[model samples]
Target: MEKKRILITGAAGFLGSHLCDRFLAEGMYVIGMDNLITGDLKNIEHLRSSEYFEFIHHDITKYVDISGTLDFILHFASPASPIDYLKIPIQTLKVGALGTHNLLGLAKDKEARILVASTSEVYGDPLVHPQTEEYYGNVSPVGPRGVYDEAKRFMESITMAYHRFHGVDTRIARIFNTYGPRMRLNDGRVIPAFIGQALRGEDLTVFGDGSQTRSFCFVNDQIEGIYKLLMSTYHEPVNIGNPTEISIKDFAEEIIKLTGTDQKIVYKPLPTDDPLQRRPDITKAREVLEWEPKTSRTEGMKITYDYFKNLPEAELYKKEHRDFRSHTKG
Candidate 1:
């Protein structure tokens, strides 16, 4: 039997690299694509020796061409973290909009099944509690964070259009906050940021009194949910995340405990357009995909903390900032 062939965008980033591992484990030919704008080559370096794995260092926002038959396309590109998107907002918008469009076109041409990774940010400082697929969302198009939130929203809209009008087989996974090994310590998300500070013996910075809530899904659990969704015939957007919620202040304390650090918490004003609460309503996922996160926060956090703790001392103090204007069109 011929092995399946899969294409995963953002293949050198946190989530995309993990997807590459999973697909390769299933004995499939994996084509990993990334522009290295925010992705690191080190993440997928280990897979270079595998005959089934190939890497393409190309930006998807520009024309994307993949030769040969493709059975699946997992669109996970784009700067997923606040630090990344805030610095490269235009690129973020293009990947979510133009990049998605390009991939959908590719999927149509190849007659392949495509799954675009959406985000919980589509709910956008959500007016509804525990966001569901039915909610329209409360996003501010002109806000600083809108670059990510709106891009995802537009991605979903275009994906659905392709599925309906173009008769393309498509799936959307509205991912929530996910953390684990390979997470960049400086991505500006709460988990890695707190863990990095604790490892460095610096005070954990809590934005906005640390009252805002976010639900974190372990990387393993998130990958499982995504895999199941792609195999299923569901056409609408599905939320894939652990519904375990925690406040930023309390989460910092948890990190302190895990890292065995004596660092105290320091408060700072929250960034504009930051969500005060974020939790996914996964009833649809449960009913359709029979999926629920099995990894508890305690277990997941310990693993994640240990991963960051073992990294080289230099990574602990390094700050990653990129100038994306040259690569991104105005």
Candidate 2:
């Protein structure tokens, strides 16, 4: 079979880089595009040697130029974190709306199947315990986190619009808390934040009594589910995440144990609009795509720690990230 040509936007971020690696390993030609706003070249620098991997510095909100018939499109580009999106709210909005629209246009031109990376966040501090794709989210459009939440919601609407109106092949994966290698040390996501702090022997911070729950799926499992969904027949938003629910506090303590850090726990004020609870109902995923998360949080953290631990001494971003964790062990 002839190899497929796939274009991935936000191809430099944690998940994007991993997707590129997966595709290239399968002998596919991969084109990676990123603006480097929240992504770093170091994450994907190793892939430069692959003859099938190509990287371009371009913003998705701006016009994207490409040639040849693309077989797949993964629009993973967006400011995903609260801190990052809060810092650059407009960019997040533009990427979700304008950026996604442009890519749908490209998909039309190339006659390619496209997957827009949606999130559990679209469910907002969900009223439903284990969020399913059919559950309409309880989100606040005027909340502090509105920029990202609303942007993602808009992306879903437009993606469906393209699918229904233009007959564009589309897939939407409502991704949950995914953590593993290549995650930015200071991206402010919980897993990396805890690991960085524990590694540096600093206090770990848990917000709002540390009772907020989340389900974590390792990066490899996430990539696998994503690849399968793209090739499968499921089209509506599918929840892709582990079903094991752990509170933020318990998760922090586990990281401390894994890292062998005797760091104390510190109580920090929770961020505005922080989701009270989040877990994915992967029942549909298992039934339709025959997909279930294979990596445990403990095993995933160990692997992730090994990668960050291998970083050079001069990589002080990890060092500075220690400041975020408090000493409270709870």
Lowest-sum lDDT 10-residue window in model 1:
321-330
**Candidates' lDDT values, in order?**
0.94, 0.87
TM-score of each: 0.98, 0.95
In candidate 1, which residue ranges exceed 4 Å CA deviation?
none
lDDT tens readout by residue for model 2, 1-330: 777999999899999999999999878999999988877788799999988889999988878778877999999999787768877777788889989999999998888999999999999988888888899999999987988999999999999999999999999998998988888777788987887787777899998899989899999999999999999976799988898999999988898888888998898898878999999999999999999998877788889999888877565253323222221111
The TM-score that candidate 2 achieves is 0.95
lDDT score, candidate 1: 0.94
* RMSD each, Å: 0.8, 5.3
Q: How far is candidate 1 from the true structure (C-alpha RMSD, Å)?
A: 0.8
Highest TM-score against the true fold, candidate: 1
Tens digit per residue, CA lDDT, model 1, 175-244: 9999999999888888898888888889999989988999999999999999999999999999999888
> Candidate 2 regions off by >4 Å?
316-330
